[model samples]
Target chain A: QQQVKQSPQSLIVQKGGISIINCAYENTAFDYFPWYQQFPGKGPALLIAIRPDVSEKKEGRFTISFNKSAKQFSLHIMDSQPGDSATYFCAASHRSNDYKLSFGAGTTVTVRA
Target chain B: GAGVSQSPSNKVTEKGKDVELRCDPISGHTALYWYRQSLGQGLEFLIYFQGNSAPDKSGLPSDRFSAERTGGSVSTLTIQRTQQEDSAVYLCASTLWGGEAFFGQGTRLTVV
Candidate 1:
């Protein structure tokens, strides 16, 4: 079963605008939620993450808004740039468990110039 | 290698042949993980090893897939009797205990 589900398999946003990607999880035991950004022919890189203890986390231009009760989280890019065009994956893991991350189907984001 | 390193970035193997992929974790990183990326599907967890603990193989797709970690640093994934459906990019990641993981350029495996 897919533990995590992401919406908008692909997204296109204008430069200098906001870009958002949303994800939901079925496993309530997950405590850590992280987003990864991947470019073509490259590995996924950690973008932003949030714990169940916080409702929102902001890291510069990247922000993760997590709703613990809803088991949903979203990534928002402020002032999206062409350079930010890439694939984004949302993942979840439990800190005390095997630490294996369950990932979403991934969203391909395009920032139009 | 300064980062997580994977050997044989691309491998083209015949169906029914056996193949082995290798991964070298970052220095001082105690946690190592393997994941597979396929078309449309996202990263699928394959296995994980943390320090000296027993490895987790629950995510393995079938009995044909196996992995082992030696000296708590390097790992090898072996597939027996390759199939075309096995084609995918295998990714390796490592991290300090409870820290964010760093990934390596994946090994693209194509079975013909």
Candidate 2:
């Protein structure tokens, strides 16, 4: 029930296109959802995050479309660039609990030039 | 360092030897967490500590793995009798409240 399943183990997209990664969870107690971007030989960095109170949150070129009822959320990258090429991970955690994040099997994205 | 810092960025030890990994979270952050990441895999929660509260060690893999946080600051993860299966990257993260977390570069342990 703690699992967050992510789709498209790997993705290849052209520049100027949209890159979308989807994730689903089973635990309904999760209130905070965050996406992380990680490069080789580096730890995951917090990219963008959202709460169940809002359905969608956008920051610059990154957008987090959340579906509380469906128990799913997605990260959408507009105008995907080569610099954005990296592994993305979706994570969820309950605010009231210990704050331990449950992450999904990462999705490796490759933006073609 | 301004961010979470881990020691011995790379450690290659012999099997059956004991190894200790360190984590120095961002100053003033009360919440700290430890995770393990294998190649091409997701982060595996190992433990969590919040201030002086009792740590949540439910995610620890075995008896050989243990950790301790001193004075609500630096933390050390001790792996006793390490095996080759323990070869992986150990990551540490910290957060101020209940929001996003900041991660360190991580310690890559290669048990040969």
Candidate 3:
């Protein structure tokens, strides 16, 4: 029962291009959404997060666009670089619901130079 | 010491045997989570512990899976009568409310 759904099992992008990954959920109670990045042999780390109150949030080359009505969200990587190659996972959680995060199947991004 | 730590980076056990995995969270982190990372399953939430309150075990796959945290610190995940399907990389993460979570390297478990 994966609450969050993610797309593009894997993608290959040219250097300096933009890589976009989309995610959707059915739980309206979810108020928080976060993206995690992981490299081989390492654990996933929090890359960015956004709350439903805000439509979007940007941190450096990463931006999160959230759509409350559609119960959808997306992560956009600007100027995709080789270093950005990793597995990206989208997760949803609500503060009132014990903060148990529901994760989507990951998307592996490969930025080729 | 500085980050979340998990033991026995790798483990292999016979089917029907029991195995225990350990996690030592960062100092003072109240939220601890256990997730299973399989080849295609991404990360599957297994259990959660928040401070001294009762652990949330809704995500546990079956009755053979159980966990407990001692003194609000170290935690352990135990699998009894292990089956081949139970083999997966077990990851542990720790975080505070509204903060970023820190994850360990994960223990790769193989039930033969």
**How are the candidates ranked when ordered by TM-score, highest leading?**
2, 1, 3
Query: Could you give candidate 3's per-residue lDDT for residues A44-85 as a string of tens digits?
Result: 899999999999999999999998999999999999999999
**RMSD vs true structure, all candidates:** 1.0, 1.0, 1.0
Instruction: Give the per-residue lDDT of model 2 (tens digit) for A1-113.
Output: 43899988999999999999999999999989999999999999999999999999999999999998899999999999999999999999997667799999899999999
The predicted structure with the larger lDDT, 1 or 3, is 1
lDDT of 1 at B84: 97
Worst 10 residues of 1 chain B by lDDT: B1-10
Clashes of 3: 0
Interface RMSD of each: 0.8, 0.8, 1.2
For candidate 3, give the docking quality class from DockQ. Answer: medium
User: Which residue ranges in model 3 land beyond 4 Å of their true spot?
Assistant: none
- Candidate 2 scores a C-alpha RMSD against the true structure in Å of 1.0
Question: Least lDDT summed over 10 consecutive residues: which range in candidate 3 chain B?
Answer: B96-105
Instruction: State how far residue A27 of model 2 sits from its true place (Å).
Output: 0.4
**Chain A TM-score, each candidate:** 0.97, 0.97, 0.98
